[model samples]
Target: MTEIRFLHIADLHLDSPFKGISSIPQSKWKEIRESTFHAFTNIIEYAVENKPDFVLIVGDIYDGENRSLRAQALFQKGMEALQAKGIPVFICYGNHDHLSGKWVRFLLPDNVQVFGEKVETKTLNIKGEKVHISGFSYKERHVLEGMHSHYPVANGQHIHIGMLHGSVEGNMEHDVYAPFRKNDLIAKGYNYWALGHIHKRQTLHNDPPIVYPGNTQSRHRNEQGLKGFYDVTLTENNATLQFVPSSAFIYDEVEVSCEGIVHANELINLMEQSLNSYREANGNAIVELTLTDISEETSELIQASSKEEWLSLIQESLEMDHTFIIVKELHVNLPNMERKESNMLLEMMEEWETAEWKHVLKDLYRHPKGSRYLPAIDEQFMDETMQEAKEILSKVVTRGE
Candidate 1:
């Protein structure tokens, strides 16, 4: 058996205009805007230095189907940089960057290869050993079909790998892209399965190693923590995986205790300490601080002002050096959300059943150009989002303290 080493990254989502950050000043835009590119660049630098056998970018490279020219150019530049180092790159399109939409295509380095809409296998001979990688890209925005069955079973001769940008059947957090089961991939008898779409990295199987490297960068608070890629070494019998942190700016959601604080100045001091400590441990971070068990006076003062105003005050008070800690949002003594809804929330949900999705998305479907590529609304996706919508709305309507 031949040993193979490669870097696996997914959901680069380059050129993502991070939402919920409009309040940030124009000067801060440079870091927030360039973070995605910076994240990917770090990964490329690693591949160049380490000299992996190849690189695997599973899917959803671009944020959307209509990718920006800058994003395309930057991506090609990274690919070319790898080509210079004699490294190869493999790519597939996820639902977010499906092939259906019209966009400008750049001339990529010959070392870069992209999987087509049909399920196909590409073989590589490294160190006189055969390596086969099987995958497919999304032609349409929604791929409800289970393409896993189309994947060729491993021949058991050398090394076989699978790349899929999809969610598991029961995963309701992210959109259902190319859906599959854990058992389905195991049945393929591949040495490794490189997955994408879900922003949080996970290990589905241990032995042969089925994994999701998560997104290289984060675009929202929901995709929190240290984001990065995976450096994998595979053999016929087993695979070893190493996670490499690559996010230039990490999305860190911190809940700080306001146990003994009375004055607003005290709160600021505590937050400053916390931020500095976090920055020391991790690199630069975009933090959303949640204050708990605050004094009555502080609560009144917090209630008097909006979160935005509080956040602005917090931002202005901080004096951070190069290892910066940006307070993106502030919340005051909010109760923890419960999975089981209260009577009042359950009553409100009764009316939601009568709601129609067609009425909600009528305008988008009616558009002359949009209707061309738009498929029917995914029912599973709708049901999932509905639950999230209920949860989000419940927090507002049922909140007391």
Candidate 2:
């Protein structure tokens, strides 16, 4: 039995800027862009040191639109290094890297073989071992049907491996692109499946392992958790797969509760301690803090006049000496204290349940004019305003009394 080892990576999304991450400094944009290339270089270095049989890139080599020339050049350079070692590369186009025009073609290394628009299989004989590889490209934007049906089943005794970029049937919002099902692949009897398009690494089967190697670098906050590639070892008996984390920066969310806190300074201290503990655990990870269940006292403490001062303190403490550490997002959920008291406010709240009151309240909140004017009115002002309005002629509306 021939021992076959290979590296699998997907969804590099190269040349894509980190959008909506305003907390990241403008100077670090270049470093962030280069980090994707650095991760790819590390993969090549691993290949050189460990000597994998070949490398498989499932899909999304570049961002979908507005790809940069620099990204292409850097990708080629990394591939060149791998080619120099005589390790072959196989690539398939995911939705992001779908070809748009004829002028986009560049001369790739002779060792790289890119699969085309059709679902076809290529067989390569490596050291007396037969390896059957199959894949297809996305010619257009949306693929609502199954592209895997076109893949031919494994024939003879060769070790069959298939690579495609698609979501299996109804995987959350991923049902649009090359939708397929697990039973379909299992019935086809492929030795292994190298899948992509999903950014989270997951394995579907064990006997003849079906895997989603996931994205090489995370692109946004939505693509959270550990980001990396896979190393697969193929044997006659069974195939073994391992995930390797290669991301230069990790993205995570941290939640802090201020249920009983009375002072902003105390809250800040608690938050700083929480952040310190998180950094100690994660070691150089970017975080977004959500301050939830903030008490009435804390809310009153952080009024409009002192908001900047508290924010400044938070910024200073979070800065520290770590260059990589950053607070990507901060949100506060103020407690609803009015709900606890039973008085005229509670009666008004109960009145909010009536259809007439509900309709009037919804219109008041939804309409721009009503929102702008309603908060400034007293009881007499509201009565006069409602009398003049056409929509609230019959509704009994009351304001602060």
lDDT (Cα atoms) of all candidates against the true structure: 0.84, 0.74
**Candidate 1 lDDT by residue in tens digits, 274-341:** 88888888888888888887666666656677778878877876634444578887767644323233
Question: Who wins the lDDT comparison?
Answer: 1
Worst 10 residues of 2 by lDDT: 392-401
Quote the positional error of residue 156 for candidate 1 in Å.
0.6
Best by TM-score: 1
Which residue pairs of candidate 1 clash?
Answer: none
